[model samples]
Target: MEDKNIFDMLENTDDELMEDFTGLCPEIDDEKFEKLFAKSEEDYKTRKAEIKRAEERYNTEGDNSVRGVERIRRPEWLRPVMMAASFVLIAGVVIGSTAMLRKDKWMTGAGTSVPEAETEDTTEEISETTEEPETAAATEEEKTVIDGSEVENITISTRWRDTVDEKIRAADDLVTMQQGFISMDYNDFIEFAADPSLDWNGPLPSDMRESEKDKIYYIRVKDEAAESIADLRTKMKDSYTDNYLDNLKDFYNNNRYYTDWAGSGFDDLNEGDMTDKTYIFLEYRGKLYVNSYVKSCAVSSGLGDSPLIIANETDTSFTAFLPHVTPNVFDYNDVSSDEPMVEIDDMYCEEVKFVLDPECNDWRIDSRIPHDSGVFGELYNRAAEE
Candidate 1:
């Protein structure tokens, strides 16, 4: 073929012309070219088959089936032909600079050329990025060390989690607990129990007000109740992903307690710390622990009807929006009860994405996007705009 025809064919992107480039390839001995071309074609077919199998495994078995595969070593002669074609394409690009500039950008951090001696290293580098399946997983399984013992990587079973409905239910379970519902405890789910005693104290308000008299008081959680509280904290850490857990801890660390100047607040004032800042003393078994904030005996009244709606679902992840009405919070001194605290209404609730954890085969909260309503949300949105 003529040089001009080669450039014209490449520029036009004629599919048939592009496919059989062996016609334009440099002349070589007939027998040597046939042998090399046949070998390379076989290698290409094998690589394609391996990649297809890997994708199938990934869909059925999750990420574990995506283990690295040993890339087939490309024949040496094939590289020269590819390089020649690349040069031809570059020449065409020079002739069609306007189209090239419009459609393509230079590769970032790409070096000019590789020495012939370093060709093998360059081939290996390219293979590493290739998605073609390798045979590594058959010989040895990936391992992780837990508690000083090596364990082979295993995927979570799809027995109980085969359906989309099941995944949605699991997401609801996590979101329900994350919203601080008092109905269920973490001990009911996770194996680990709460710490027996923790001498942690919350900061106190700058000054105690008369209105906080009945509102701010410490409740002594002893025996089973104290253990339950500790277990809840432990389970919360396990349930949430790193970001949400950090936010929860930051809220706890920033919270300040309020105490009355007249001393005794709750029923057993002596049992609770009466320092400048109030502290709730929890007695787990026989030991005592202090906490900054604890949920009081208040009913968790809400809009009642709310369901977790999942969106953008895939084999590995999904976005869930739990729409529920926010409960109206009454002040410490608000004695007049009028329309009631909760009403059956709809609002943007917790927005979170649940991702399938390939390691354990269970669903975990990947991320939480805060979607609040009422006064707090308005203030937050306004501030964000500013």
Candidate 2:
């Protein structure tokens, strides 16, 4: 038989091959056996042609066809299996080729990749080659650390002590005493006593001795538009005295204010002398002294009884004044010890005038002397002598 005829007969045959000849005829009982066989032969020829074309492309473009060469070698009987396998194999080859082409994008190497070769040629054309390592020198500035704590000391100016003394004296002179009228112009006092130079750093003298205490009482002027300073003082005094009397009644009832002294002599004295009295004092001995004159003045002025009294006792050499005589209590603790003691610098109209003893250490003026004063008169006098 002719070679072409023999090949055609072999391609058309459906007879099952023995296990030994499995390589020659792969499909044992396939329904499309003839078609599969024909397709296999045609695929092999197409692959062979592809290999030749790829080899030519490789030579011309400096690419490779080793993968395409590998796909064509798989057997004819195993064509279905080989075709599926070839798809995976071809994909792997394409991926590998792409990676090789992009190798310089990801890796630094001794051998030139396509992109690197092109970059080298472009640089050569530009005539701007990078300098060699031995010839190159760094031009960066060195970092520095600075010490900023060595600046010069600044000088501050201060006022003389005599200037402050004069201001206090001027405030004292503003007091006026008349029949049924005891008043002080606070505005005039503040104006004269305003000393810009006074150094406010020393401790103030606490509740003063009776003799040194300012006898002139100050009344805060409440009217915002009152033109005369004297009118302001009168209004402040009237308001203060009215509130004082009301608080006194509350105190005598063994109420909130005087309740602190309940079991003491203050309790019994409140029952007798407090009746029909505008001002009552709890003396050092704890006896209540009722003032009838102040009561009459309070009634005529339409002001309530004075809740507190200011008394100068000869034995103690101290002036006693009750706080909260007005509706609001003037808190001595709120006042700074560093500030001038007698000067009413706070504009809040909250301070009640008190005469503080230099030797007194009372935390509250009514109580025993404050603990900070060293043994009261004893240590203080000795220190003064020294």
lDDT of each: 0.38, 0.28
Clashes (N, CA, C under 3 Å) per candidate:
6, 14
What is the TM-score of candidate 1?
A: 0.31
Candidate 2 per-residue lDDT, tens place, 1-64, comes to 6879876755533324333356665655676877788899999898778656643442332212
Q: Which ranges in model 2 have alpha carbons more than 4 Å from their true place?
A: 1-196, 199-225, 239-330, 333-386
Candidate 1 stretches greater than 4 Å from native: 1-215, 224-231, 251-304, 312-316, 327-346, 356-360, 365-369, 374-386
lDDT of 1 by residue, 138-207 (tens): 2333433222433232222232233333443333332222233333231211011222242223312213
Which 10-residue window of candidate 2 scores lowest in summed lDDT?
297-306
